[model samples]
Target: MARVDRGAADVITSDGHHLAQYAAPLRRATVDDPVALPCVGDWAALTRLPEGRYELDAILPRRTAFVRGGVGRDSRGGLSGDSRGQVLAANVDVVFVAEPALHGSDFADLGRVERLLALAWESGARPVVLITKSDLVGEHLAGLLDDVAAAAPGVDLHAVCSVTGEGVEVVRNHLGGSRTAVILGASGAGKSTLVNALAGEEVMETQQVRASDGRGRHTTVHRELIPLSGGGLVIDTPGIRRVGLYEMSRGVDLVFADIEELAEECRFSDCAHESEPGCAVLEALESGELPERRLESWRKLQREAAWMARRTDARLQSEETRKWKVIHKSMRGRGRP
Candidate 1:
């Protein structure tokens, strides 16, 4: 439920304890009125009707929001190029990155995992790396889990097979009530399978992946916020194979904490770690302390994030100009000139 007006509520809890499922008309206010309304997960005062219906009065403020940058449309139905990050959800606590498992022969793809880790870290939520199909990999699983841990420092990592229920209990224990988590990964990454195991029901659909290609078919098509039977909420988004780093500079540093720490000891305070004198990051590589591949990945993500930030900022500035122009035009349309 949430605050609506002087003493009214814009939303209330449904009998299902889900989002308020009803949309009521303004009793005193008429049509064509602007909406300054409440959103999901808001607390509202309610007036119960004899028919067992309820009315929302107001929307309480939100604690936090999960957002991503997106483009806006213009009058011609084309993208204005001006973009802004749209809020995906609010009050999320954990970001579950369900990734594909690597059997003995091939190493699990670390690049993609790093990107997801950066995204999760940037979301201001705890990131838990859930590696699926550990049972299939047999004894070689330990090395793969270690690789993931090395890729993402200071994050909880788990390997589970939905079929065998391996490590499922550990994953469930992390989702304490009142805390929310968002699941992100590629198609066929076993996100739905994990969610089903956590929810203790088959709420989401799942598909079998192609053995030859190592890719799974898409089962979930929409971004839905599902309530776990235990207590907290889990937002299951569609299979996201590609996650573009829009503006996650701070997140990059956090994800590559070791490299960042090494750079701090460089001779120059602003050392770029690229052919620079007295570069500690490079020294670590030569001394076998840091792998060259890890440093390269760090540089790639940093560059991409920086570039994306520039593009997004440019789009935002253009959008702000357009909004002001429209407002000025509306003002002139109302004046006698």
Candidate 2:
């Protein structure tokens, strides 16, 4: 589907035709689970009914689905419980991690960049770092780029100024025909501005960030796919505040490869990198090789990802057990002893 609203979607077909399609009864019933619902980048199977209606029957298997853990009610339907992943975008080839250049030239949030990179890596898509509003921090741009580069490993990083049209084409080159990209960032990150600039038109709404706090209003509240003039597609998503990890250990390791490499050289196989003797990670910290803050960020993400994995496993196990119980009860009832 091109875009998914509350229950409806705008589906684009092979012939470049678009239509508003609503979910069929069965699919609607499954909408409560975000995984089962049709997302903006999903390719869905639609059925045409006699009364001029289009039914989104099913979503095709996605090559890649970008998801993040979101808080939801539990079995008891209480106010708080374990979080589950909400699908962000499907079948994406690249994720552009946008961080706006701060006013008065404050340092960009590399910690958030690390977090976003981990999530992006977990999405099974290549990630590119875009420092939006590059013109704001022109003189101070080089140092900021170096800082972000250290945080992001093996990722293409760029400084893009949407209003001034700097580095915009380089960004667009990533989204050619058949390749899809999603812009991910927090509010006031100049994501909407970048999107509009890339589309070469005012396709997405733009808002000015507050000069005091350097935060932009939530202009793009929902995820929507916009087809570019050059043939590829781009999905614009709302600014994400908290980026909770969902089973991304390898991603974490990849993002922090410097620390990972150091960990492998530790004297003990299970060194916690604290006060352990012959700890390579600790050595790096003490020698100023690895910043303490980065190490802390890595550890925090690792723990959160592990916790999310455990919760996911438990939830699936409970669901499976419940299904078996219901099946056994039905079988026993039919026996009529």
Candidate 3:
């Protein structure tokens, strides 16, 4: 599926044809489950109705999906207890995390990049950090890149400027030959501009960031998959304001692999790394091998991931309970009849 909306999706056929279809979930599919719904980069089975309208029958199994904790709103426009995992994109091979070099501060937000990297790693896709708007940083660009690189270990880092067309080819190289990528970032991070650059045309819209805050509006409202003329596909998502970690596995550990490695060398198996004797993590921190900020960020993300995992567990239990209650009620009704 190229794009999925309320009750329809834009689907691309095997013969390279595009068409919009009324895509609704099958009756057996759980509508509450985000994974059951159609998303960008999904391969779907469609059926033609009597009137010749195409209806989506089912979504094929996904190789990888990008999901995040999503909170639903109440009737009063406030957050409710409907916290579920929302699939951002499905069947993605590469996840491009875009962070502008000249944002609020002089450099990109390393914390945000790390958080996105953790989620990207969880998505089963190769995470690539794109430091957008490198032209504005001038000579400090190299230092800024190094900082981001230190934060995101084992991930490819590229300093790209959509305006000047710098470092775009490096990004484009990853998207050749049927590989699908998704661009993820906050507002005004130059994600849309980068998509346009990669597409080699003005396929996506662009907006100028504010002079004072350097933040752009949510230009791209929905996630749409665009097939590049140069072979490959890209999914462009909206500017995410709050990114909550969903059920995490080894993603957090992978993001903080350096810390994990140090913790392995700690004196105690269960060492908290807090003023412990022979703590390798603390030793690295003291010796300037590890930055204090990185350690703190790792700790913060760990706590968040743990909390979200518990919340997801509770939600699943509640859903299972509700399902049984309905089943019992139906049995009682059948007995009465």
> CA RMSD for every model?
6.0, 2.4, 2.3
The digit string of per-residue lDDT tens for model 2 on 1-337 reads: 7788876788887666556566556466574456666787888878878886677877888988788877766688764425567789999999999998776644688889998888888888999999998888768899989989999979999999999999999999898778999999999998989989998999998888886766778999899998898778899999998777776757888899899899999999999888999999999999999998899998888888888888889988887999899998999899943
- What are the lDDT scores of the predictions, listed in order? 0.72, 0.85, 0.88
Judge candidate 2 at residue 234 and give its lDDT: 92
Question: Taking the tens digit of each residue's C-alpha lDDT, what string does model 3 give over 46-141?
Answer: 886788667788888999999888777889999743458889999999999999887435488889999999999999999999999999888898
Per lDDT, the best of the predicted structures is 3
TM-score per candidate, chains pooled: 0.78, 0.93, 0.93
Ranked by TM-score, the better of candidates 1 and 2 is 2
The residue pairs that clash in candidate 3, if any, are none
Residue-level lDDT tens digits of model 1 in 1-337:
3212333333425554422323354433322212223423344455566777565543345564444544557999986433345444445688888887854465577888888888777767788998887777777888889888988988899998987788888887787867777787889888888889888899889988888887887888755667788877776777875566646757788889999899999999999999999999999999989988799999999887777788877866886999899988998999934
TM-score of structure candidate 3: 0.93
Model 3 poorest ten-residue lDDT run: 19-28
Ordering by TM-score = 3, 2, 1
Identify the runs in model 1 with alpha carbons over 4 angstroms from their true place.
Answer: 1-14, 17-62, 71-82, 327-337
